[model samples]
Target: TQASYETTSVYGHGHPLYYNNVINCLRGEAEPETDGREGLKSLELLIAMYLSARDGRRVSLPLEY
Candidate 1:
């Protein structure tokens, strides 16, 4: 059986809330409730992953990227 708490957390709350937040932010109806730095960090991680795969070496991402 699926864990009740996990299912509720994701389907009932997490997904809808995050979706609404993104929609609202895109429409300029509300300020983002999440930290903008986290999005930047995710982008940095993606770039690092791509660079590492392309160059065949470990890559350290810069904070400004």
Candidate 2:
């Protein structure tokens, strides 16, 4: 997406921190930031955003999927 960002920020829009966390978790250096349920919530919200944009309507939270 290449949004405006600051390289010094630990939490950038490109999600370097997220990938780092995943790698660290895989190497047993850190715990997973979120479990499946939390991940599901985020996925649902992202899908809802796309649906709302595509259909030109508001999408509700906690999608059925």
Candidate 3:
């Protein structure tokens, strides 16, 4: 379900074709996109899954139940 960014040149700051930014633009949010933050969240989920498997324990969210 990912949007395509292949047409945007690097000098374009990789804008326009990027999915989140487009959605935000349509919504008039005008805030920055979630490019790096999305990757960070994916990494966090991977780490959580790894820790759960290694420790043989259920890994729950630390802040919220």
Candidate 4:
């Protein structure tokens, strides 16, 4: 058995909506709903994944620097 995915957009996914929002922001029509802080956190997590995979060990967030 299987199940359908969940979403709020009529277009099935968020990419197009995200792009449109970016364009609107660039045109000074809308404010960002989110910011680079989250993106930086995500990048940190990705770096942790790479480190753990390379070293074969558990990794922690806000990785020691």
Top-TM-score candidate index: 2
Put the candidates in TM-score order, highest first.
2, 4, 1, 3
Query: Per-model C-alpha lDDT, please?
Result: 0.79, 0.85, 0.68, 0.88
Q: Which ten residues in a row have the lowest lDDT in candidate 2?
A: 5-14
Model 4 C-alpha lDDT per residue in residues 1-65, reported as the tens digit of each score: 88779867766787787789889999999998768997789789999999999999999889998
The model with the greatest lDDT is 4
Candidate 1 residues 1-65, lDDT tens each? 75555454535757688789999999999888777788778778988898889999988767344
Cα RMSD of predicted structure 3:
8.7
Arranged by lDDT, best first: 4, 2, 1, 3
Q: What is the lDDT of candidate 3?
A: 0.68
Off by over 4 Å in 2: 1-14
Models 1 onward score TM values of: 0.51, 0.69, 0.40, 0.64
- Between candidates 2 and 3, the one scoring higher on lDDT is 2
CA-only RMSD, every prediction: 5.6, 5.7, 8.7, 5.3
What 10-residue stretch in candidate 3 is worst by lDDT?
Answer: 8-17
Task: Report the lDDT of model 2 for residue 4.
Answer: 62
Residue range 1-65, candidate 3, lDDT tens digits: 99765654664654454666768777998665656777677667878898889999987754132
Task: Give the per-residue lDDT of model 2 (tens digit) for 1-65.
Answer: 77765666775555887898999999999999888899888889889999999999999887765
Candidate 4, pairs of clashing residues: none
